[model samples]
Target: MNYQWYPGHMTKAKRMMQEDIKLIDLVIELVDARVPLSSRNPDIDELGKNKARLILLNKADLASDECNALWMAYFKTKGYFTVKVNSRNGSGIKAVEGAIQEACKEKIERDRRRGIKNRPVRAMVVGIPNVGKSTFINTFAGKACAKTGNKPGVTKGKQWIRLNKNTELLDTPGILWPKFEDQTVGLHLAMIGSIRDEILNVDELALELIKFLKEHYQGCLEERYGCSESGDVVSVLGEIAESRAGRLKGNELDYTKAAAILIDDFRIGRLGKITLEFP
Candidate 1:
């Protein structure tokens, strides 16, 4: 499948981050725990060079704990300060401040050498759209400081939110690269709702999801929808439609509704804690 989701605002957002990165002491990047590598915009490595980096595996509560551990180890080996967090409920937010200080310890020490005291660390939160950047900002700030939406492109501008005298956060709009060279990266983004649903064929995406689940997480379909897991993707979707009472005007199974339900259930963790990619 071919997938593309680039908005005009993202172009402007990328330019803005280029300028904002110069003013920050750290870059706190959020990535979906389920597809950590796929959800990240590779351009950030160049954009945030020489900056203290923290990678928060946001929405971690919905991903498999085993995968989360592997991802944390993967990022740590790459020298990034990493943490697992459920940003919506503020489960791991408290550790963020200490991690910030630790990640920027070199910068902090330089400030102390130059006789600088009590200067708050300036940080900017960045991620691909819908990866919970705004939600992480709000939970970290202890207030609804950043506007959030379930869909991509909810935040269109930059705002600096002060968490305390010791730290300040710049909340910028989420961004994606100009193009996805690998179709698998695009597919992962689409599965996790990082891309808009309107531009996608929900049934085809659901089929891809079903195929992945059957291969990687055997028996999930049978456990959730009471359908045999051995059939083709469409037949499994049809089973889901029948189980969920989805029907059309002519009494045909409503595959569209069933597809949407299946995707939603997976997104919100109704199926179970699942991880799409492993390190």
Candidate 2:
């Protein structure tokens, strides 16, 4: 299957990221815990070079704990400070403040040496679309955060939300385009609802997902849909449809309805916390 992203939007996003990078001491990036490698656009590494970086594996609750740990170690090996987070429920969110301080210790110390004391660290949240970037920003900022309106000589209409005495966040999130050169990456993004479902053939994608689950998860389909582990994607899909009674007027066992059920199950974690890929 072929997937395409807009070059014009990518260019504009890159430009905006560069501008935002200039104004921050650290970059707090969010990646889906289930598909860390696929959910991330490493172009930020080039744009955010020489800046402190922290990777938040968001949606941790929906992903396998083992894979999340592996991704954390993998990113740490590459020099990024990593933390697993369930941003939707505020789990692991508290640790981020401390992580930020630690990530930017050098910058903080430099400011201290220059007679600048107690200036709040500036941070910008960035990620691919639909990776819970908005949810994270809202959770991180909390409802009580005051929107520090525009100040002179600092971009005419920029607004920063003051999180506390030690932190201030740019209200807007930096959106990076999903990486799509790899077919596996595209599939993972499609599975997560980041890529538009209308652009994909759910039946084909569901088949791939079935194959993955049968191989890696081993009996999730049996437990969830009371279907045998036949290792047959199409038949297993049919079983799911019959179990769920996904039928049309003639009751001819709709593969489309079955595919939708299978896809939604995987997307919403009904099949369990399964990670699609590693490293």
Candidate 3:
């Protein structure tokens, strides 16, 4: 699939982030653990230059534990303070404050030397759409300080939230890049729900997901939907439809409904922990 999605608001969001970055000491970027690289908008590196960086592998519960560790080490090697987080349940959220302090230790010490006491370290949460930016913010701040939604573009403007006396958070709308030069990146984003489902062919996307799972995570389909080990992806999807009772008025198998069910299963981790990308 030739995938590209850059809504008009993203242009304004980027411009706003450029201005907002100046007011923060750190950029707390969140990426989907299943597709870490694909879910990230690399523009943040330039926009947040000279700023302390923290990369939260948000929704880590949906991704393979092995991959999460590897991705954390990968980012650590590149100098980003990394954490695995499941924002929905606040798992690993408490550690974020210490991680932020560690990430900005130099800045904190600089202020100490200059005698600028009690200044809270400022941070802004950023990520591509639907990667759980708002959820992370709300969980980290211990309240519904930011609006939480499953759909993309739920956060339309910026809001600063004070976590404690030592830290403050600026929540910004998720921003996607203008173009996806690598189609694989686009596909990964679509699989993780960062891309809107309305503009996608769910059947084709499901097929791709099936193929990837079959290759990297053998037995996943058979375990979930009793799909046969051998056969084309379409046939496997058909088997899924039959097993899951995806039917229409005439009792015909509804591939579209089956596709939606399977995709939802993957997104919510009902199919078990899965990771779509490697380091």
Candidate 4:
């Protein structure tokens, strides 16, 4: 399936971010731990040039621990301060403050040299839709400072949140680029629910997921849905439908319902600590 979903507001968001980047001292970007590279917006590198960078692997609890370590090392090698965090439960949130200070240490020292004191570090939090930027803000700030939701595009505009006397965060709406040059990137985003479900084919997506699991995470499908994974993807989905008792009128197996169930299960991490990509 060809996956592409870029609304008009994203263009406006990108423009706003470009304008706001000048005021930001650091860019704190969030990427889904399961698909780190795919969830990142490529335009951010240009927009946030010359700024201190930090990458938070949000939803770290749902991804493999080994893979998370590799991702941290990968980003660190590229000069981005990296942290593994689960914004939902506040795990790894404490390390962010120290990482932020370390990332902006040079800026802090420059300000100190200029005789400026008590100036809060300005950071802009950005990511693609549904990657947990708002949740991280709320968790880190110890309050519901930004709107949080399970679906994409919950944050409509920019807001400034003062986390403490030493730090402030600029929360911006999650934005994706205009086009996905690599279709695999789009597919990875869709699997992680960063793209809206209304524009996707659920059955086809579920089949693609099944194919991945069969290759990388063998027996995951059979363990969760009691479905045999040896045959074609379509047959595996049929087995999943039968196992789940997903039947429509006339007692026909409802592949659509089964597909939705599998997708939901994966999104919530019910399948296992599975990462879609490796470093």
Q: Quick one: best TM-score, which candidate? A: 2
Residue 111's lDDT in candidate 4: 96
Better of 1 and 2 by TM-score: 2
Model 1 C-alpha lDDT per residue in residues 1-279, reported as the tens digit of each score:
679868566677677777777778898889999999998878888889889999999999999999999999999999999989999988888988899999999998999999999887888888888998878877788754443222233233545676787787765534545356888888889999988999998899999999999999998889999998888999999999999956899989999999999999999999999999888
Q: Tell me each candidate's TM-score.
A: 0.91, 0.96, 0.91, 0.91
Scored by lDDT, the top model is 4
lDDT of 4 by residue, 119-163 (tens): 889888888888998788778988644432222322345566778
Candidate 1: segments with Cα more than 4 A from true spot: 144-159, 172-178
At residue 217, candidate 4 shows an lDDT of 95
lDDT of 3 by residue, 1-279 (tens): 677787566677777777777778998999999999998886888888799999999999999999999999999999999999999999999889999999999999999999999988988888877988877777777754443222233234555666787887765533546356889998998998878899999999999999998899999889988779699999999999998856898888889988999999999899999999999
Collision pairs in model 1: none
For model 3, what is the C-alpha lDDT against the true structure? Answer: 0.85
**What's the ranking of the predictions by TM-score, best on top?**
2, 1, 4, 3
Model 2, C-alpha of 140: deviation from truth (Å): 0.8
Question: Given candidate 3, what's the lDDT at residue 153?
Answer: 33
- Alpha carbon lDDT of each predicted model: 0.86, 0.86, 0.85, 0.87
Off by over 4 Å in 3: 144-159, 172-178, 249-251
Runs of candidate 2 with Cα error greater than 4 angstroms are: none
